[model samples]
Target: MSLENNKAFASVLTAGIILLASGFAATMLYHPQDLEENAFKIEVADSGAEVDAAAPAGPVIEPISALLASADIAAGEKGFKKCSACHSIESGGANKIGPALWGVVDRTRASVDGFSYSDVLNGMNSETWDYEALNEFLAKPKAYAPGTKMGFAGLKKVDQRADLIAYLRQQSDSPAALPE
Candidate 1:
């Protein structure tokens, strides 16, 4: 072949090779793996104990009142760091990602002016931020009020939640009475 034809042939060959390699790589990457026959097998309990698959996991949380009795406001202030990203506890504090929490304790739900609240919160317009309500909400925001806009993963430790709630109570002009 002439020099120009040879160059053209080489270029076509290189293009064809690249195309074939890309196709091979794509097939390898996109191919689904076959699941093993035992992939979904339920393991038999060796101890002869019955397992209830439908039962809820985790320990039942105690009432917030019991926890609040010994809640440490200082520790709660520290725990408030997690909330500071979204909330401002200072009186008359400007709303950030969340509504300012200056008087959140005992305050009506979704009552902040100018801040847009989620429909879930708005639906609870008659509800107050009482201790039990706050605890339940904090324990599992999604569970307490499904479709809540609060992104908190929920405080797992009861004491930490109490502390956080205490700190919030202190932020108010007139803090709500602690649970008996």
Candidate 2:
């Protein structure tokens, strides 16, 4: 073919290729959801179906033996700062934002004098502040007794919770009377 004719032919071929490519690009852009829906998928088992055989029977509260043995009163005192915003640890202390925490370690949940608590805490009258109860309550205040006035997000760390309990115990009149 002549040079001009050959160039014209090549130009038409290039234009056609470009046009084809542009059409494909435009279609893909406009129909992205369709491309996503047509993607390869693999089926997996639902995570909720798996049973945790090792899960504890009751709420995972810290043990009394471990807390009494290794309980650090200093750390507990430091942890008590969080509670100090609402509670008073001094013996025979009056109630504050929440109830005074004096004698609370072995005392009942909401038995403090003249201080009104939410129905959740009041409902726990029979429950004593033993190690297990304290641990469970401190781990998740709302979970232990729903609708409690104490708005604390329970201390997740077992050791820290233990420390706070120990510090509170020390502040009580009968600190030695607390279960070992």
Q: Which tens-of-lDDT digit does each residue in 1-180 have in candidate 2?
A: 799999999999999999999999999889644464647675333354667779754555657647665789899898888888988888778889898887787787679988998987777788878777888888988667666777788899888887877787788777745454
Per-model TM-score on C-alpha atoms: 0.72, 0.64
Best by lDDT: 1
| Global lDDT scores for all candidate models | 0.86, 0.79
Candidate 1 structure quality by residue, lDDT tens digits, 1-180: 699999999999999999999999999889787876766776332452786889775457667787776889999999999889998889889999999999999999999987898898899999899998888888988767777788887998778888999888989889898888
RMSD, one per candidate, in order: 7.9, 13.2
In candidate 2, which residue pairs get closer than 3 Å at backbone N, Cα or C atoms, i.e. clash? 76-163
Report the Cα lDDT for candidate 1. 0.86
Q: How far off is residue 146 in model 2, in Å? A: 1.0
> Top model by TM-score, which number?
1
